[model samples]
Every structure is written in structure tokens, then in C-alpha cells.
Target: MNFYTVLEYIGMFLVFVGALFLFLGALGIFRLPDVYNRLQAGTKATTLGAFGAIIGIGLMRPEWLPKAILIAVFILMTNPISSHALARASYRRGIKLWDRSVVDRYGPYLREKEEKEGKR
Candidate 1:
């Protein structure tokens, strides 16, 4: 097979893999017990899924490579950061963790910081 044809096959495979992960992410978001867990599932899965899909599309269309790379970079940068900000906000807003959650690391750290700063 020619190189471009090989790339097309690889791109198609990646697109399918990406779609599968995206579907799984949606399922996790729907089925998870709490917002924190759902956010964790959605953020991590979709970041990789979208990056793969964008790069796959770029491979299929050589002219789109630069734009796809930029979009992938943006997703990689923003998804996790936004997920973190949302989780922290939810925790500060008095959202409770899932009943089975084992540790409370952030709560203790925040309390220490607040106590040191003398702020509520």
C-alpha cells in the first residue's frame, strides 16, 4: 500500500478508537454516582478521545494538520484545568464526595490554608 493510503487506514482506526472513548466517557458521566466521579471520567476520557479524533482528521486531510494540532493542544491544556476548577468550586460550595470515597486530602489542606490566613 502507498504511504497516504496507510495513513488513511491509520486515521480511520484512530477515529474509531476516539469515538469509542467518547461514548464510554458519556456513559461514565451518566452512570457515575456523583459529580466528582463523573467529572473525573469525562475529563480524562474525552481529552484523549478528542485529541485522537482531531489528529486522525488531520492525518486524513494533510492541509488540516496545523489547525488540528492547535485544537488538540487547547483541549489538552483546558480540559484538566477546567475540571480541577469545577471540582474545587463544588467542594467549596459544600458538595459532598461519594459515600465510598476513602480520603479527604483537599479538605485538610484547605482548612490549613484558611486557618493560617485567618479567613473563612
Candidate 2:
């Protein structure tokens, strides 16, 4: 097959994979036990899914590649930041984690900061 045709096939495959990730992300949001876990699902998976779809679109329409890549980069940069902000807000607001959650690195950090400030 020609180069463009091969690219089209790859684009189609990416789109399919992106859609699957999107579906799984949605399912995880609903099925996950806590807000943090849901946010994890929503941000990480959806970000990847969106990136895949955008890149796939770029592949299929070569002229649109630059814009698609720009959008993908924007998403990549923002998604995790937004998710972190949301999680931090939730934590500060005293939202409890799932009973089985194993780690809480943030709590200690926050407490240390507070102690330092109080001592000042």
C-alpha cells in the first residue's frame, strides 16, 4: 500500500484504541469507589484517549497534523495538573479516601507545612 493509505490504517487503529480508552475511563469513573480514583480514571485515561484520537486525526489528515499535535500537547500538560488540583482541594476539604487506600503522602506533607508555618 501507498504511504498515505498506510497512515490511514494506523490512524484508524489509533482512533479505535482511543475510543476504547474513553469507554474504559467512563466506566472507571462510575465504578471506582472514591473521588480520587475516579479522578485518576477520568484524567489519565481520557487524556491518553484524547491524545490518541487527536494524533490519529492528524495522521489521517496530514494538513491538520500541526493543530492536532498542539491540541494534544495542551491536553497532556493540563490534564494531570487539573487532576492534582482537584485531588488537593478534595483532600483539604476533608473528603475521606476509600477504606482500602494504602498511601497518603499528601497528609504528612500538609501537616509538615502547617507545623513549619506555625513555628515561624
Name the best candidate (by lDDT).
2
Model 2, span 1-120: residue lDDT tens: 999999999999999999999998999999999999999899989999999999999999999999999999999999999999999899999999999999888888989999999999
TM-score of model 2 relative to the true fold?
Answer: 0.90
List TM-score per model, in order.
0.91, 0.90
- What are the lDDT figures for the candidates, one per model? 0.92, 0.94
Query: What's the lDDT for residue 68 in model 1?
Result: 92
Tens-digit lDDT track for model 1 on 1-120? 899999898889988899989998999999999999999899988988999999999999988999999999999999999999999899999899999999889888988998989964
Worst 10 residues of 1 by lDDT: 111-120
